[model samples]
Target: MNYRTILITALSCALVACQQTPTKPHAPNNLVTQAPALGAPVAVYTTAKNTEQRLSQGTTLTFAKSVQPSEGEISVFVNPHKSFQTFIGVGGAFTDASAEVFAKLPQDKQQELLTAYYDKEQGIGYSLARTTIHSSDFGSHSFTYIEEGDKELKTFSIDHDREFRLPLIKQAIDAAGGELLVYASPWSPPAFMKSNNNMLKGGKLLPEYFESWAMYYTKFIKAYEAEGIPIWGITIQNEPMAVQRWESNIYTAEEERDFLKNYLGPIMEREGLGDKNIVVWDHNRDLISQRANTIFEDPEAAKYAWGIGFHWYETWAGGTTMHDNLYNVAQSFPDKKLLFTEGTNERFSRDKYQHWPNAERYGHSMINDFNAGTVGWTDWNILLDENGGPNHVQNFCFSPIHADTRTGELIYTPSYYYIGHFSKFIAPGAKRISTTVSRSHLLATSFQNDDGKTATVVMNQSDDDIAYNFIVEDKEVELTIPARAMQTLVY
Candidate 1:
């Protein structure tokens, strides 16, 4: 069900509490506890009103031997034995625009932000990152690697990105301990490759330029590798169905299938880069299944595609719900992978700038998407200015972190904390384990990482507090979650 369909009701604290501080040491009357283990379940919580707690680490919840799982209270049951999709990671795009503004900050501040995003011990380590093939809507201007009409690509250059993005990527790789898996996406083909002969608006890539454009992908991959920043994967095009005023190109499902089967896929194999992922349909959920089916049904095309990617815009736009489309794709292509490629709230509303609801959207979507079978999730822009720009098309959007390039000050929005509740604890290669919530309002997802640790994140979007027992392995840990808050328990 969509977020709007869920009925939100108030949950009373007395239902789950016995007159104790939420975070202080308190043993529920009936449960027996032993001495605390080195790695007991710890909770980190964030409240909506910016009250109570704000992504603060709370007291550890002790494991009990003999308490019957509360039947009347809401329950979150986690089953690591029944694991599912392996998680790739979570992160945001490293646009040239983001790097340009980031470069404006003092060197110390720049490193601070980088370390905050990529250092596992210091911050929420982001393992996956997206970068524009040339210039996306976030760039200062439209650009391409190849010079005008250079189909042979003798004059191709990534110099434009080297000025800002490449260096920042290298720094981020260092901060991440080289764990970053970078993926590249193109917003539009060069002006010469499109029938409209312009990159600023929707156009069609001429069939004649198919091979040239396919070669362009390899050139970009090789060039970035030369810079010490390997391109792990690439989407054929960004928002392939949209006709936007910004850098965009339209590719019908049939067109995309033919291009990949005949040109892109064959070339990658020929160049011995078959291992690099080729993701299809970098669009929204509204038509995701339809687009995916058209291409994936074609054995020629299906053999080359690593997975299907989608954005959350369709759900926010009141179109198809993200989870439904995700489930559809998962059921139909059980052998393939799924990824949440891009999403961000646009046209920042001052009324909701630091609003917890904005952050709630991220948690809500991520939980649902993960449950629906997405391996990785990537947000739109990693960083944006206070004005939400550097965007050439004037399409301003909110980011997890906003900075004052002029003052060198940074503002961490609730989105950052919400994402941290997941990305920080759930490491790459983690498997999404089965989780069931007794109350619909208590939206949650659980995972078991390769390290053998498990994390369960529960979010309460309702107006009341919830008293619930998190049950696993026949042991139970009782916890109370505040209304309009999220809690992550890592054990």
Candidate 2:
């Protein structure tokens, strides 16, 4: 839970590329440059400053030579970032924005901004997005494909979706430069199956309706396929361990295991829906052991699920666990893919109000996650209202950008710039390379493209300048890093 505090403080950007640097520690004075603000005067380095500080583009970016590659190796492809959990995708309040906000914008302007956001990945990168099947913690209230208790499940339909979600989602997908990774998850079950009789409060699917729920997932896959959106994987539940005050369900490990093995597994297979991937434990990192045990106990459940999903809610870090505890699942369940399903530093809680330095966040997360064998990485709320959203749910965090709900306005958040610092450049097929770090506060990661190009990312969390050396391929470079900054170097 304190992760939000740590993460929020790391990326409280109000801003990518190669923000990489050297790995050794030195002094702070070396990395200092005449930095420029978002819209500030461009600096002109005099010949004297350039001679003394080795400045370029008016910035003092220095390099220090290394004696040897940090210490070990992190090969990008040979030991690729492995994860069985395929992405369910991520987007937010934006689906509703068309009616509430985008409708007010001129058609040309709407098309332009939409293209910029959803299309950037098409040029050389990739984008996999997620959305709720209906209402979610970020939506107005609890809802499903249809009103509840209509037996025989004949009325089960996503017809209402065509008017809202499908259109907006389709628009974004088409805008993406390449094929989009599309998946859907539910925040709650149809109200009928709940004990409280409302999706707003948590409920357990009364065992009798198990088959119906399985069919529900299949129907969604079939429906999306009909609309040209293929459902790649269906996460059994979103945040299984979270019993929130909004649309949610409470499913214990035993319940999920039984449901996946006995109900969902057989039903989907019988329905010839076996090609789709089944994932479990769409919860936080702390619950990895719980998920591991449940999947391990029920051999049948383990057989059906390709992998598991986790969030960054709790800080599972300790000095002795091979790296932090976040790596334990990958360390223990090496064969099962680990997908980080849903995460956001600013979940709109009063606790989210603060400044998290940008360098430590996106850079650090991408480092740890890929290192932990996470193949699919996504954030919550692709877009939100300027004030975070027209969210009745209040706890809605956001993506890199937010389109105003009342007016056609766009506001880019730090998270957007942060994600772009990575996603906009690293394509899906790209591999993370091996790396080693010797300094405590100096964090690092590396990647290798299929064509043999090299990319290394490093972040210096200390408040002072540091000197370091980095060796890529066979060339060694010396670097001097400044305090309060992060860097990425690619060759």
Candidate 3:
């Protein structure tokens, strides 16, 4: 598939072809660019410097015969032969609020946004998606598929989703060539099933309603599958430990473990949905290890869980980051997968939408998360209006693409370009390869795609342009990455 290049400056930027390099000869002390070796050992670079170029197709990078002796230079070593985690691909969420805004756009503009996000040749090529099981903070209002106090769930119907959300998802799936892997998550169960008798505040799932709630999942999954959208997995709850004004439910690790071990797990198996992934602890990475331990220590609960889900909010709140906690979880439960289920910039402002730092945050987190053993990454929203959201609870946040609901305009943020630097080139099932860099300013991760191609993404976060040597086996490509820029060297 042909991938479209993106520019950090504006959404209207069009695709540009790769430029051929000038063949000027160089002296021994200067950087020497040798042609790529025959067959397998070769590399080319495409970069987005956040100025004139965004995902600009650049010249092929040939490995030099020897490393040049220079000051303030760094070296990045890549080992495609030594690979780690298999990537599940990156994508965003589909929320009712997003669909509402999307439906307001003109038909042509709606297709443009979809192409910008899911078209493998012309967009970022998102392969996975998350959807709210009922309603989230991003929804226009609180809603549930089942009627109040319907303990038997005879009234359970996904007709609510058919209105806007599912249709938007179907279009995205079509654009992605029917390769979208969708997972469902609930912010809260129906108000009648919770202790507080309401879904807005922190409430506990009533013990009496446990079985019905488990069955509720089965019905919803079956309904969606009938609509041609397979449910890839389901999270126990979204941010189970937090109490928000928006819809939320509190499930201590113990509560979550018990529900899965006794209720959801057995019900799923009995209904022939056991193969569907059941993820635990859909919360922050700060307490991820503790939660994982609590749930996985029980052999019964562990058997029910397919993986662990986490978010990036903890680090943003001045708490600990992924390194310690993520390492702990990976080391403790090496067999289970780790997925970044939800994350996005907060306190939305239109001015910050184009902000490069926000985009850099995504790159920084993604590289570190991959190094820490995350298999997949999912952003929060696929699209929001110019106001950041039509969020019922006023929990506004920025998305990669923001639609001008009044004028039918689509605005692509810097995050879109930054995310494309990885998602556009790296295909699903790619394995994270070993990549070690000598300097602190440069952060990077390498992946060998399923197609037998290698992609190495390096970001220069420092203010000054720094020359670097990218070495893979016997070959070393010498190049200078501009300041505050990122490049993907794919071969």
Pick the lDDT winner. Answer: 3
Each prediction's whole-model lDDT (CA) = 0.80, 0.56, 0.81
Please estimate how well model 3 matches the true structure, expressed as its whole-model Cα lDDT: 0.81
- How much does each candidate deviate from the true structure in C-alpha RMSD? 9.0, 10.1, 7.4
lDDT ranking, high to low: 3, 1, 2
Best by TM-score: 3
Q: What lDDT tens digits, residue by residue, belong to model 3 across residues 288-357? A: 9889999999999999898899998897677645656886787788778888999899999988867888
**TM-score, every prediction:** 0.90, 0.76, 0.91
Off by over 4 Å in 2: 1-109, 120-126, 315-323, 347-354, 480-482
Model 1 segments more than 4 A misplaced: 1-48, 66-71, 316-320
lDDT of 1 at 74: 84
Question: What TM-score quantifies how close candidate 1 is to the native fold?
Answer: 0.90
> Taking the tens digit of each residue's C-alpha lDDT, what string does model 1 give over 1-491?
11101101111011000111111011112222222243366554444444645556667677664366555778888765566777788899999789988888899878878866777756677888999989888978888887899988999999988788988999999988875889999999999999899997899999889999999999899999988888889999999988899999999999999999999999998987899999999888889999889999999999999889999888656664657878888888877788889989888754566777789889999999988888889998888988888899889889988888878987777787788777777877666777889888899998766556677899998988888887775667778888788887777
Give the winner by lDDT: 2 or 3.
3
